[model samples]
Target: MSVASMLKNNKLSKAICEASWATFKAMIAYKAKWYGKQLVVVAKNFPSSQLCSHCGYQNKDVKHLTLREWQCPNCHTRHDRDVNASINIKNEAVWLLTAGTAGLAY
Candidate 1:
């Protein structure tokens, strides 16, 4: 899903709109090209925040913003919401990069 679709009826939509995420993304894209690096944007609906970085578990019950810290039920690992989400996003981007090039001769 795209960011626009994911933002519909979402509280963060207003903040994101005010922040000009489109322009930010554009700038990142331009910088990546200039530096010969790739910018891999995960699908907007990806459950990065709900995913456990330690055990690859998805906690669907964590739907409230108030739940800022959570323990992975599978791994029993504690995680800070923002930190875990950032780790998950990085993992997802690395996976995407590797998967996309897995079939190449080089």
Candidate 2:
């Protein structure tokens, strides 16, 4: 709402994110690179949860209770939040490279 309120909220959100970055990054990065899979870190603004990995469908409805678990309504496939996001990030990197838009979109 107000400038101060916005700043306060931003700082709090950023602090929470910083605390989890290492663990999340390590989990995805290591697993991906371990088997010769490219690891990608998409821009933080990318919407992973809202996109369906199986169908390229996007939705606005998000069930917070299933933050770590979800089934894509369009395809009836279950997804693990972090895992799907990581895969999506990797795809994005490859897509960017092929599209000649970015050397590393991640």
Best by lDDT: 1
Where does candidate 2 stray beyond 4 Å? 1-41, 63-66, 103-106
Candidate 2 lDDT over 1-106, as tens digits, reads 6544654785676666675786787777777767876554467778877777888677556536467777888988788877877777777878876776653312
Best model per TM-score:
1
Residue 95 lDDT, candidate 1, scale 0-100: 89
lDDT (10s digit) by residue, model 1, range 35-106: 887788888787998999988999987768899999989999998999999999889888878888422111
Count clashing residue pairs per candidate: 0, 0
CA lDDT of each candidate?
0.82, 0.69
User: Residue pairs in steric clash, candidate 2?
Assistant: none
